[model samples]
Target: MSLTSEERAYIRSQSLARLATIGPNGPQVRPVGFVLNDDDTLDIGGPKLRESQKYRNARAHAEVALVIDDMAPADDPIAAGWGRGVEIRGRAELLTLDAPPMAPDFFSNDVIRVHPSRVISWHIAPEGQARDIV
Candidate 1:
């Protein structure tokens, strides 16, 4: 399924995301920079991607989770609540693609495309309730 406008916009506004993978020792989570591809798959790249533990872990286990979120600026200083974000759980695969022009010099351009099976979003509703998409 395609992403909602809100979802797409949220992704575009963020630069960092948490990538979760299963390592040989156990579960591993790392901060990663990604681009939201036209096809809706996240293109994640880094230096030495082929040799990275995350890549190895993805090759061994496809299951993964990616979280993109941040605290929304509070209009009312006294207002308190939870932060807003999206969590994508799905299978991942490695892809070797031409690097985006904006990619850092250290990036290798190899990326992991996550095929989301489920998406959970919080604070997107008018009532601030979490819901599943796709």
Candidate 2:
């Protein structure tokens, strides 16, 4: 399934995510600047993106996972227990970056495009209980 409207909104509100991919040394995860596409996909980019290990890993292993989340607000009623997040398991496509949503000066024209195969969101979770949004 694809991302729901709520999931898209949450992702749009955030700019960073943790991209995990398998590499020669096994699994590798790194912080990335992300852009939510109109097609329900995500573009991960950063400075020297083409030279990054995550980019190389995505080229070798097309499967990847992205975790985009934030701790609940300090005043949130469930701040001590619940949080908001989206975990996406998808296929990665190494491509040229286009119209990044983050700091344009810090990102190169390279991107790891993620096409979601599975989407799990906890943006509206009830105190530690995570559920699928799709």
Q: Judge candidate 2 at residue 115 and give its lDDT.
A: 92
lDDT for each residue of candidate 2 in 24-106, tens digit (9 for 90 to 100): 99999898888888898888888888898999999999999999989867666544445788999999998874554567877
Name the runs in model 2 displaced over 4 angstroms.
Answer: 77-81, 98-101, 125-130
> What TM-score does each of the candidates earn?
0.87, 0.85
lDDT of 1 by residue, 18-117 (tens): 9999999999999998888777777777888889999999999999999998887666232235588889888898888776413668788688889878
How much does each candidate deviate from the true structure in C-alpha RMSD? 2.6, 2.6
Highest-TM-score candidate? 1
Question: Candidate 1: where is the Cα deviation over 4 Å?
Answer: 76-81, 100-104
lDDT of 1 at 105: 80
lDDT of 1: 0.81
TM-score (C-alpha, index-matched) for candidate 2: 0.85
The C-alpha local distance difference test score for the whole of candidate 2 amounts to: 0.82
